[model samples]
Target: YLNSFVDNIDEMKEKERYLMEELKNQENNFLGIKSICSNKVDRVEEISRLKIEMNRLGIFLKNNQGLNDFSIDDIQNKIKEIEEYYVSDEEINNLQNKINEFKSKIAYPIIEGVFGILEENFSIIDKKYEEAIYSSMGSRSKFLVVKNEKIGNELLSSNNSSISIIPLNKIKPKIVPGDILRNVRQLGGIPITELINFDEEVSKAMEFVFNGYFLFENKENARKACYDYKVIGVTLDGTLYDPKGTLCGGKIICKNIIFRRKDLLELEQSFKEKKENKRIYEKEKYNLNELKSKICNLREIKKAKNDIQIIENSIKFLNKLIESKVDYSSELSSLRQNIVKKIREKEEFLRRKNVLETEIFELKNKIKSKKEDEKNILKKILQLEGFRRQSEIKISKKSIGEREEESLELKRKHLLQNILKSKSKISKLRELLKEFKSGKNENSKSHLPVQFQEISDVLDDFKLSSNIFNVDLKIFDVKKEDELKKELFSVRKEIEMSKNIKK
Candidate 1:
């Protein structure tokens, strides 16, 4: 994130420079217009001083000129007048002594003193200049150019060999204010260096005239020496002359070392072929972002769906519980009815057993009464027998025999009646006991009883059947609906992505 912001700083700096320059140019233009409206040509020196004063104002203003309004003809005429002012005899005579004093102060004089050096040191070189075969070289270095080949040979013959010689055309045209061209000698007794620091000269000259800079090349030779330094070219008037081939639609390099205009166009054209590929990459990135968002949305939707499913499941389970409760209640009702019926039947059996118990009680009492009567009869018989024995003793055999016969008949009749009564009571008791035992076992109006275990088994079977038949109707098509919703969402997502790509 910070990279984009930092990268913008350099671009902002460049734009700032451009806008500053433009503003400076406007200020200068207005200043020039004021100067013109005032009609003050005499204030040219003040105007020139303004250029230097406003240097910080920037390049744009400098190029447009500051506080110095003049037509094209006016500029030409002014330059011509300044040239004449320096050469006129009255000014020259007044400055002659100062010029000589100035000459002693500087080791190498300015561009004007270049001629003085040639005249004093090189009379033969001057002849070559007048003949257009040579020119007096102007440089910070003390050197001379001899355009004639014969003059070069003459200098060599004179054995003033400390002065080097070379062909004039070998010199690059754009010489800087201080650089020198020379042919200096070494131990070989032959002149070697025909050019010296001529490249710096061309650069300054280009900057002065073109209001820009240049980089130059022999293309092949530049690989050595200052390997990164490319040569530059200029004209005598300080105008930057194009390198021989570039103006003719040939290759050229800019400050950034990129080729200018035509070459840049070609490079841009090559990039156009990859445009489709870049578009595809951008589309894929957009799709990835979209898909990530969709995934997040789907997650939310899925959670909602799961919540719904959970609620449905809970409802269904609750419904099942309610149905089970209802079925259980129904079974309990049926069990209650069966218990009531059994209770009624038990009551009837209890009533019958109570009647049998009453009969058994009466039979027991009757048997006890019969045994008491028999005991009494036995006692009376014993008393009668004893009385008969005593009488027999007194009244001989006839009296005893009559008494024994009467007693024997009475005993036989009584014994037979008592035996019949005892048998009838015993039979009655046995029948009552049988009836009570039968009553104890009977249930639900049956001769046989219903077991408790049988009733429990019937209830369980009924409950199971009821539970199997129960259903929860709320979630009939929930799963199918959820799946369909998911599928439709996916399809819509794909369609949106397709539209985004087209856009």
Candidate 2:
């Protein structure tokens, strides 16, 4: 019976130990379930936050896309406006046609009705002689240089006022004597005929026009040499002085009628230059438009690609989170209930944190706005202080009486009247004194002859003494004592009146 009792005690001890170990294992499982629930809650919260941020980023991207489109449209509009001022190909073509037409007309002869005379026959013999020939003959250089006298007669009989005929046969060359030519050369002058180059047939005509006229460096030397030598003189600047005293002088303009070929060439060159400039500007405008289009396209494409990449990354992150998920079906119901309660607590804490953070942000914004208002108020205060200082300075610059007293105006007018009266009295005194000194005062006519003569002698003596002493003693002259006294009294009265006005 003793051995059976001992065996029962041992079995009861082993069963108690097994029951304690099972309780510990169940507690550890509950803790693991709680930890898993907490991890799930954290992951869910992070996903919610990501969704909100993504929504905000999407809206921002959408707005930026709209702005980019508007920018592109604005650039396109500017390009269109620039196009309005751009020269077109059609206009350039029309200008080119006009230039061609001008070239064709320039090749025509200056004079039209000469017989068998082509435009080549009327050429300027030498370019260097163009100015001298043009100046000597004037518009006659445009006439055809023909050997036939009948053509010249026919041109003159045509009665066209614009046409001039210079016949080589009718021209009689003026022979300048050798002595006159030697004197002209000594005086720094050259014969005008020697300065020009022309055909032998036109030699007589050139000599008839400018043979005797000598060209000098300037007008003064030409005028002096011309009068001294008794010959016609022409200055290098086209100033002409004839022995008959006829003078013709002014600026010598190279008339386009004289250089018809040169004028045509210059006009054609100018037209080509303008056309080339227009083409360059058009090419530049086209290149600028193309560059702007390319830049805008690249920007749009890059922005869209970046936005797509960000969305793809976000989707990848979500997929990764889904792949990392674990099943928690074996968790205890009590732990799951605790996890749900804790999640609600965590949400409430987040809400409170958001509210507190929003309050902090609002307070910070209020502080920032107040600081800006303070700065604006300080600026206004400084401006007002500056105005106040300026006003003070202006007030200080004003006269005290002008600023504070209305009666000063009346005082000024009264003082001016008194000053005028004093001036009049002084003028009358001066006139009386002058009359007395000159012996022309009617009031002093009753004086005896000897007394007047004696007064004149005294006045003459006083003038001599005053001149020697360099003093103004005229006021003390015996004949003008009363007038001088009156002048002194008037001056004193003016001084007193001025003092009273100041007070």
Candidate 3:
């Protein structure tokens, strides 16, 4: 999210730069027109300025085509109407505005420069290639082209999520094989890109989008171009055909979106007509001082006065557009900065949140392990008690004669007394015996405590004696009350020893 915000800021900076340059250009244009006239107007200089502006306008119209519907008669009639001076002041003012409006429509949006505009606005398409251009370029014709991937990414990162940009640095022209081009042309098709005119700077972008397709004169030819040549193309009627048996086309709403060839020719024709108009006025120029000395015709005076009004109104209009872009640019900057700070703060918060979650997970795992350890320890102690009880019963069952049994028991007690007294020794005894019985490892038997080892040796001797005692038990006399008391005392001693081991 923060990366996205940083991208937005970079885009805002570009927009700001574009707007500032636009502001400078508009201001210069406003001042340049103002400079053409002074307190005492020079008619020749005014005509010269008009010629220069017209030439500049002509260059601009090449990239940004003029309206084809606007007839040359409108301008010619405006000029002829001006001679009468009988036309309303309002009408003349509107006519002059009509002349400037061509630029007015195209300039302000670019001056604002909040979004990237396409280098080719389908203005490159002439009438013959409209369908092919549409099929080849499609919605991508509306895609904004930028200087590099960084600029494209930055612009896309802004709040306007719906738009896309093509970075010139990232795209390459699609290469069509020479044989394919020759074959296509032989089939009465021309590569659509050939008909469209675009700048060399954007040639890569243009061809990358458009060069793959061809324009055929009709649907039948277009179908053949698709089937035989295995290439895509469209008919002049706007039907699209692809080699994959795809056929899809309909009229795309192209008013203001596309410019036909005639639109461009008409724009050139306007400049030519205006040039002729300027030439007719050019022959009438008199010496500057001499013209100033004698009063000029009322019609010529009206024309100069009218031109001044138009320029002044244009300056006013430009000032408004300048303020609008400046205001939007400032707001956009502040918005981007705030978003940057916000994203940074949120990212820091996310980092801390992750750390806390990790700690919580580790703590939970530790608690669960300790619980399992506790249950295992309790199970081991219960098992040890059961083994002790079973061993006592086995030894008692082998006892027959009191004298021999008492002697054996005393000897075993003396040896085990010190071992049982040491709780750590008892623990080691259990550990070693468990390891040894399970065949855990070679080291278990060798590592037993010395006292526990002596007890083990004595138990082995008792096991050997028990076998011999079983044979003698049938012949031995059984002592009753006195034996019971001795047995109870021995059990108490064993209980006390077990308690010491527990500690």
lDDT, candidate 3, 173-219, per-residue tens? 77888888898888888887788876666677778887768888877
lDDT of each: 0.38, 0.58, 0.57
Compared with the true structure, model 3 gives a TM-score of 0.31
Q: Candidate 2, TM-score vs. the true structure?
A: 0.28
Q: List the residue pairs that clash in candidate 2.
A: none
Candidate 1 clash pair list: 133-147, 174-201, 174-202, 175-201, 176-201, 216-231
lDDT of 2 by residue, 177-223 (tens): 88878988988887766665555545655666667777777667688
TM-score of each: 0.15, 0.28, 0.31
The positional error of residue 33 in candidate 1, measured at the CA in angstroms, is 99
Sort by lDDT, top down from the best: 2, 3, 1
Give the candidate order by descending TM-score. 3, 2, 1
**How high is the lDDT of residue 61 in model 3?**
45
- The backbone clash count of each candidate, in order, is 6, 0, 0
Q: Please, what are the lDDT tens digits per residue for candidate 1 over residues 179-269? A: 1111111111111112212233233222222221222223222122112222223221222223333221222221222112223334444
- Sliding window of 10 residues with minimal summed lDDT for model 1: 183-192
